[model samples]
Structure formats: structure tokens, C-alpha cells
Target: MATFSTRYSRLRDNVEEEPNSSAFDEIIMKQEQIIRDQDEDLELVGRSVNTLKHMSTKIGDELNEQAVMLDDLGNEMDTVDSKLNNVMKKIAKLTHMDDGKCTCSQT
Candidate 1:
């Protein structure tokens, strides 16, 4: 895409070819350093993701344990409620008896 007028400028003609090789080497070195830094950053991100996964798994296990304990507590409360209802029914029957007197005969 070089136009004839732009391709042959005075500044381009005056530059020496010796520095181009050294400049290209420096550019390659800088690119390599940038890639190494990117690799390190990706490794750090991977470690962080693993840590987050481990923490979430532990929290899930703890939640499951708590859910089981809550279920047991609910079952115990139901049992207590059933016992209390039976006691209440017995008290009601006793109260309905003839003014708290029993109908037993004397020997």
C-alpha cells in the first residue's frame, strides 16, 4: 500500500541499517517479558478460583449439616406436642367427672 511519493522520503534514505537489528531485538525482548508477566497473572487467577471453590464446598457441607440438625429438632418438637395433647385430654376427662368425686363402692 505504499504510494510512490510516501515510500522514498529523505529521512528514510538518511537512516542507517545497523541500528534496525538492535532495535528489533529490544522489541522482541519486551514482548517476551510481557508474555511472562501475563502467564504469572493467569496462574494467580487460577489459584484464586481454586480457593473460592474450596470455600464454597465447605460452606455447602456446613449448611447440609445444619439442615439435618434442624430437621431433627422439628421432629422432637412434634413428639413433645403430641404428648402435651394427650395430657390435656386426660385432664379434661378428669375435670368432667362428678365434681372431682369417684364412683367407687365402699367394702
Candidate 2:
């Protein structure tokens, strides 16, 4: 039977000249399980990042659309303001004409 220290040394180093097979196999299995768990964690993080990226893109698109709509509304309001100014000018001219006209005198 191998000494306790010899068995411990074999377990610690994977490149042992005379590996105790059961201990090596156990170590490999545990290491594989740890690697799998790490892979799963990395995959979860990747998915989360992708989701956030998509949401950010969506938000940016919506903001762009809103800005365009605001620009259009501003342009339309300017047109309406110009038309209103013309109507006011016409009304002022009509008022001046009325003031100059003589009132109908009763016979």
C-alpha cells in the first residue's frame, strides 16, 4: 500500500509518474463539472448582454422617430402662424376702409 504522503502527492500533481487511478479519475471528473458550470454562467451573461443591446437599440429607434415627428409638427405650426398673420393683416385693412366710409344719412 502506498504511504499517505505518497497518495497525497499523487492526488496533488496530475503528471505523477505512477498515478493512483481512482484519485486521478475523481479529480478529472470534478474539474470537468467545474468547467461545465463556468460555461453555463458565461452563456447566461452573454444572453443578458444581448437582451440589453436589443432594448437599447429599440429605445434609440423610438427616440429618433419622436424627434422626426416633433420636427414635422414644428414645421406645420410655422405654416399655420404665417397664414394667421396674413388673415390679421387683411382684417386690419378692412377695418381701416370701414372707418373712412361715410355713414348713410337719414333724409
TM-score of 1: 0.68
Residue 19 displacement in candidate 1 (angstroms): 6.8
On residues 1-107, what C-alpha lDDT tens digit does candidate 1 reach at each position?
87665555465554655568778999999999999999999999999999999999999999999999999999999999999999999877766686877554459
Instruction: Report, for all candidates in order, the number of backbone clashes.
Output: 0, 0
The weakest ten consecutive residues by lDDT in model 2 span 5-14
lDDT, candidate 1, at 25: 94
lDDT of each: 0.89, 0.89
Candidate 2, residues 1-107, lDDT tens digits: the string is 87565434345554767768898999999999999999999999999999999999999999999999999999999999999999999777766676596444358
Indicate the worst ten consecutive residues by lDDT in candidate 1. Answer: 9-18
Give lDDT: candidate 1, residue 43: 100
Q: What lDDT score goes with residue 17 in model 2?
A: 71
